[model samples]
Target: MVSRMFRIETGDDKDRRDLLRRRLLETNTAASPVLRALRGTPAERQRPLHLWVMDEADELAGGLVGHTWTTWLHVTYLWVDGRHRGTGLGSRLLAEAERAATERGCDAARLETWDFQAPDFYRGHGYRETGRTEGIPGGHQDVHFHKVLAG
Candidate 1:
């Protein structure tokens, strides 16, 4: 590839040309190691992973996981340790998840909780019941909730 340097600052042609040449050299050197490492590494595939852990007394209180896509954030899993129940940990976890979703540019967050799960907990946090499925031959059905983020 042919390399060329051009001045970018007004009225400082020589200095700008030198600066551009230095920048190009630095960029090429910075990327060479990564390129060489990936030459036999099968293209070095990667994916983004985010993890959050809540702890109490050195024990795991809860955790949440989600994946982001082009236009939406999908919540893959959420759990609060059984010993931490009734301690507001679940609500705090939900709030954290919502904050993360908003930060990731998601306009809304969605999740599902069983009938025997923390329905009231989610309701208290502004999540509204949008759907439900009953008569599953089990003791309880499933409920889904969603919250919209304000601009």
Candidate 2:
């Protein structure tokens, strides 16, 4: 049997902004109870945040949240629905994000994930492990990865 995928496009700036707003609200709703507790209690101010939504079949399949600083494009988060794993959709979304970074003149992309997440998946796509922090809140070390782009 063949599977079908549909892309929902938010065409204009206003539409994209609205879509992002809704996505954030949905993400906050789905986050764990602990995260919800710390949601708005940051002690310090931070840089601007940007969000991109990946919608497939009218549902949110994944999302990319990041910000560009100087020469680097830091990917704060990249998530795909659990049911949609191993479907090539993550790769497609990452490629799109890479293209966007290149267009924005970023020299590289960086992100971090726990061991239980998709470290192997990123490594398969040319990302290299750059740093690691042991014993995070849940006893899992966070691994940082980076992918430098050719101009």
Candidate 3:
């Protein structure tokens, strides 16, 4: 057997990151038939992304971006402009996403929120905190929320 030392690259490199991600996915998929099957599902093969925006004066006010997968709508990002906060736009955006997800055969929605983010706002919209991890970044917490979509 031959032994060799490998050099490690440091700093932000999008190409390297993407290459690593591809390699890891390939390795995982090759090792497990279950993983391959899961990824080959009818719904998994189709990953459509959606972005709902709230615009004012040709400027961005708020938006909801997510993707519906199989049985869950993963809310990637939800942001409302500070001036537009508390105007129910956030709730409306969430409701709109949920509606789209339901139409796509999704039965639930899930998202992760930072401690400084609107976890309470999501809770008010029928999402419940399913998990929490503290000390994420300088005493901050990461909260996971999930909501069942209406059929």
lDDT string for model 3 (1-151, tens) is: 8879789868999988867866776676678775576645443433655655647576888888787765689999988899898898888888888888888778888999997888888888899999999889688999999998889
Select the stronger candidate by lDDT from 2 and 3: 3
Candidate 1 lDDT, tens digit per residue, 1-151? 7879776556658876767755764555457775334322211211222455557566667777765432244566678788877787766766666666666555776667788877887788888999998865676878888777654
lDDT per residue for candidate 2 within 1-151, as digits (tens), equals: 7878888865568877866766765565457574445434321111233544556567888777776543467878888888877888778777777777776566798889899998998998889999999989888989999999766
Instruction: Tell me the whole-model lDDT of each prediction, alpha carbons only.
Output: 0.64, 0.72, 0.80
C-alpha positional error of residue 65 in candidate 3 after TM-score superposition, expressed in Å: 1.3
Any residue pairs clashing in model 3, and if so which? Answer: none
Off by over 4 Å in 3: 1-46
Better of 1 and 3 by TM-score: 3
What ordering of candidates by lDDT runs from best to worst? 3, 2, 1
Clash count for each candidate, listed in order shown:
0, 0, 0
Segments of candidate 1 deviating more than 4 angstroms: 1-51, 54-58
Choose the strongest candidate by lDDT.
Answer: 3
Task: State the weakest 10-residue window (summed lDDT) of model 1.
Answer: 39-48
Best by TM-score: 3
